[model samples]
Target: MDIKLDAAALEAFLRAEFPQVAGEYTVDRLTEDGLVLRMDVAERHLRPGGTVSGPAMFSLADVALYLAILSRIGPQALAVTTNCAIDFMRKPAAEGSMTAEARLLKLGRVLAVGDVLLRSDGQAAPVARASLTYSIPPAA
Candidate 1:
């Protein structure tokens, strides 16, 4: 499949539409197949146990898939999450940043599906995996 937005374009789109989260995530790499997103972890992302919270992990997955969709369809903030399923596989160390590798498995006019694998900055094993579905609203 062809990508409508490249790394630079994706970065700009995120900064413009989602300013609050702009610095939290970055488009490290983008290609014809998928994109690599880096999450800048902060103290707020952790729980009392010094581990990343489920909500934080979920947010990363959601953003990754959403960005993946935008990378193909251009800046479409109307694309919203319709459903999601996430599995927390391993505990993330509270020491470092996390990364989510997301890919668009399918993209259509009304819906998009993708999965994200998340791990600590240097860990090889995934800390979580999320399957997400996005609803693309009709263009105005």
Candidate 2:
């Protein structure tokens, strides 16, 4: 379960691959067990009710799990999300950043599965939970 991409590695990968979100996310920690990624939320992440939107949260969940999988398999950009299921359990803090903790459940040659727990900064309970399956492409 050792990470293929640590905090620094994830950051560098983001810069090289997805520059659009590089400034929005920060990798907090990565280890053999899991990875912790923090989202630097802005006013744009909120919606009409001052709650984080589903898409915004989903993106975090998706990317968090994706990064976690990559941390184990290395930078495989073609490793794409094949399936995802998420539960929106609670509303996040209106004006704060959020954190996503992701762990790989199974990593196979062609598919990787992981779960993500997302919470507003400093919150005790997760605002959302997600499970994702990624399709890993053949090494090229």
For each candidate, what TM-score against the reference? Answer: 0.94, 0.95
**Where is model 2 poorest over a 10-residue stretch in terms of lDDT?**
1-10
Candidate 2: stretches off by over 4 Å: none
lDDT string for model 1 (1-140, tens) is 77888888888888999899888887788756668887777899989978999998998899888888988888898899999999999889787788888988899999999888998977889999999999998877
Per-residue lDDT for 125 in model 1? Answer: 97
lDDT of 2 by residue, 58-90 (tens): 999998988888888888878899999999998
Could you tell me the TM-score of candidate 2?
0.95
Q: Give the whole-model CA lDDT for all candidates, comma-separated.
A: 0.87, 0.87
Q: Global lDDT for candidate 1?
A: 0.87
Q: List the residue pairs that clash in candidate 1.
A: none
